[model samples]
Target: MGTAALVTGASSGIGRATACRLAAHGATVALLARQAEALEQVCREIRSAGGDAFVVCADLVDAVGAEQAVAQVIDRAGRLDMLINCAGAAHLSSFADDAPSQWQCMIDTNLSGTLNVSHAALSYLAAAARSDRGTADLVTVGFTAGRQSGPVTSVYAATKQAITAWSEGLRRELAPSGVRVGLIQPGLVDTPLARRLGAGPGQGLNAAVVADAIVYVVTRPAGVAVAELVVRAVGR
Candidate 1:
């Protein structure tokens, strides 16, 4: 079977870049995100570049919707070879001043969202490992904040920690099934989330850098698993 990859948060930033990278590598990519217009634009970009892609606009926090979205990707692509969880939310502020709403938003979008989609795609990924590719991949984008929690990153750090923890467990559980589960920790990426933190347009590593790291992780030989990676800009 040909390669088929589903990338969450594909509307912008790292997600969008990753989807395009996977598509360019000959994977039939399914771009999943909450924004229909942005996703359609990415879809058009991919098709115009002679790459295969489709859009699946759905909130990953919604379990049923996530399941249906995964189904749509598989139905459209015929199989699922890779799943990249790049959808995320960040509320950067001191814990003393952070609101519950911010906390909830980060948890829902970062942790729960990844869980919902990975849970939905587990079986299909396992099956894909048995296909001609001989392996399947699950990748979650994490952050360095998860390791060094600072004053303004308390809650965001917690969610990323949870993601890495969950991904580690999943790696162990899926290893026997020929499924490679991995995590990417990108430090100071110049994304929408970073712009919210007041980063300039060209500051930090571009989203495409992390996208390249993701492609490297997923494209390794079946017997070699790149379980964890940390990508930082040259001067970062």
Candidate 2:
């Protein structure tokens, strides 16, 4: 059987691109997102390309929903070989002007959402690693702000920074179990999400560029674990 991978935020942007890329590599993909219709569209595109894909619509912010999504993937695919935690949101504003709800959305989706899905998928990843795959992957998408905080990115930066530290700890903990944990920090991406953050056209890397990096990381030799990757546009 081909490898089965679960990709969160698979409705658009990096998550959507990653799902398609993984499917192109002959992996069966499970697309997870809150938008049922959008997720279905992604699945249709994948299937039309002769790649297998299914959609799991659930809000990662809800711990129960996150767990259910993982369970659904396992139920549909029989096994999971990789998880791409790419579901995230950002709200940029000065600290003084930021509303509590906006900060809460970023925290819940970017941080808590990641935690919920990873926590729910641990055992399955471990199982996959022990099987013929020999190794399993957990890839998290962070931001350049994760490495360095900047003005107007206080809460968003905090969430990415938290992911950076959390991913490192997971890398160490899962190494012996043959599960690889990797983090990708992209400088800027031209997506709706980026536009919402006030990035102008041509300001950042394309979402496809980051998706390519993720594909590279997950497809490396089983013995080679790319623990971290930082992608920045040239001369930026």
lDDT of each: 0.93, 0.95
Kindly state the number of residue pairs that clash in model 1.
0
- For model 2, what is the error of residue 76's alpha carbon versus the real structure, in angstroms, after optimal superposition? 0.4
- After TM-score superposition, the amount by which residue 38's alpha carbon in candidate 1 deviates from its true location, in angstroms, is 0.3
lDDT of 2 at 83: 96
- For candidate 1, the lDDT comes to 0.93
lDDT of 1 by residue, 48-101 (tens): 999999999899889999999999998898999999999999988999998999
Clashes of each: 0, 0
Off by over 4 Å in 1: none
lDDT per residue for candidate 2 within 10-75, as digits (tens), equals 998899999999999999999999999999999999999999999999999999999999999999
Clashing pairs in 1: none
Model 2 scores worst on lDDT over the 10 consecutive residues at: 194-203
Q: Give me the displacement of residue 141 in model 1, in angstroms.
A: 0.3
Q: TM-score of every model?
A: 0.98, 0.98
